[model samples]
Target: MTELLSPTLGGAAAGLGVAMPMGAMSVLLLQEAMRHRRTAMAAAAGIAAVDLAYAALATGLGPWVASHIAPVEAWVRLASALILLGIAAHGLRTGWTAPTPPAAEPRGPATPTPPAFEERGPGRSPGRPAPPAPSGPARPAKAFARYVGLTAVNPTTALYFAALTTAQGASLATGAAGAAFLVGVGAASLLWQQALVAVGALAGARISDTARVWTFRLGYGLVAAYAIKIAFPLPTPG
Candidate 1:
């Protein structure tokens, strides 16, 4: 059996190398994390699961898949590009049309404070502010489905790994090596994604209206650019 350390480290580094770049999926994941942490975590885990599966497939059956599914892969890439473009347009429209929060109503003297300090519940604090309520219900299933769909159909991920496996030349000894690689990749993905979640939690209070608007715009623009790149291909020799 191949040692775990080498494969784990190599796999982690390889996974990060592929995943660290900001892409449509990354943006969506981050946005979800910022919007709803628990659901985003589920979605992130789903994406990691897809990555592990892909890594195994690439390691075990790279050549056969690449040979038999070249045209299908091309179509998937085009479809992904179109999807990205649609998401970008939606983001832009949403940012432009987001509604302002309703104004707070004025308090009147008729509102009476009947309870004294002695009557307060054991767990309740008199002066401390209550924690903000959850924004809304979480859609973990839908989010997970979207994450899985994007990852399963992403051509860039397939192409990138195919290239990587080809370059590595099946240097792996057996399925054990592939398993180790997947473990490492999954660990790294969990670490990075959780880190993003932490950052989102920490920064949730500090993000301003202007910053939020611009962030959406930046994400939309990047997605649009990626779509354009895919839609307009470079000339190839016959």
Candidate 2:
């Protein structure tokens, strides 16, 4: 019990620490939350899923994975940077474009209705006001898949977990201890991501549409800057 508890707690702490950094993924998550809370949560789940998988891999096979990744770390970083830049470019493009207006109803529909009878759709009644239409489909599933792919491409995640496993001297722990650790990591990261999402949602509720657009632009700008930094990182002092 003690052994399992130790790894679990350690993993939780590590997960929080790693997730606290405001990387491109973080920016994207916040932008998503501001627009669609449900989609943001889905993206958060994706991030946590990747984090959990990485934690498990690191705990069980850190040395081997790290060794293999070391050979192409630069290429991986470059690829990640390119992907981020592409996402940022897309965001900027969409943000600048005017929203499409709803199309006019077709002219051929002229069904006669009785004066006394009211047409009520599902989950709606005669007295109650109709619920506001959704601005767009939440598309949470698509967001989940996109975020999962984005987070998976980030080499730093795997490397960071691998480093932690090596430092903790638990890289070979693949039994109950590792499982507990992974659960802790997933829970902690998910909680943190959700907290971020909540904050963004609240801010979105208070802001104007113009403000939201500017905020979205700022997020993509930050992501672009991060990508540039990753593509050409500063040299460390000797």
Candidate 3:
């Protein structure tokens, strides 16, 4: 048990180190946090749950997981690629239709009147209020499904853990150590993700509309790129 405790805790910390970077999922999570804190929390929890499941599967089943799960990885990659492409298309549409930034006025002579805020398009009634912003709690089911799908489709995540486990096979003794490592990794993941959600929620309030729009486009673009990389893996040495 004592031996397991150290390795498990160490593994957990290492897992956090690997996961802390702002990847596609992180960006998505941040975006969600900005839009809906509760939803973001649900999504983060789903991701962490999946990670723990994968970690346990990798640590315990090892090669068998690869053999059984590898086939599904292809379908998952395809689905993820399609989802990313859809998101990119949505971004492109939104970006194309987005209102252009008002040009700056000339400094000398006549001071130009600032463009009046248009609540609606031309011909619309001025008295009509703007559409209400979405304020309800995020849908837990949808958020969970989205994150779980993304995580499940991540090929690199599986490859990384597989490699790590294979290398550490000798050191991963059965009994308390194995259990401890799993617990540590799970705990670390939850802690790190929750922290990320909190930071994202706090920062979201300060984001400008233009900046938020651009971020959505950029984040989706990156996700599409990642999907492509996963779909068409680089050739390995024979």
Residues 1-238, model 1: lDDT tens digits: 4376776776776565444433334444544555668887877777777767777777676535445555554444455456656655655664545442222112322212111211101112223332222233358887677667656765545544444443333444456766777787678766765665565555543234465456556545654564555443432334
Q: Whole-model Cα lDDT per candidate? A: 0.52, 0.57, 0.53
TM-score of each: 0.52, 0.54, 0.53
Best-fitting candidate, measured by lDDT?
Answer: 2
Question: Which pairs in model 1 have colliding backbones?
Answer: none
Clashes per model (N, Cα, C within 3 A): 0, 0, 2
- Give all candidate RMSDs, comma-separated: 14.4, 14.4, 13.5
Model 3 bad stretches (over 4 Å) = 63-137, 205-238
Where does the lowest 10-residue lDDT sum fall in candidate 3? 117-126
lDDT of 3 by residue, 1-57 (tens): 566766776567535633443334554565567667889888888778776777777
Q: Which ten residues in a row have the lowest lDDT in candidate 2?
A: 115-124
RMSD of 1: 14.4
**Which stretches in model 1 have alpha-carbon errors above 4 Å?**
63-137, 205-238
Query: On a 0 to 1 TM-score scale, where does candidate 1 land against the true structure?
Result: 0.52
* Candidate 3, pairs of clashing residues: 4-177, 8-181
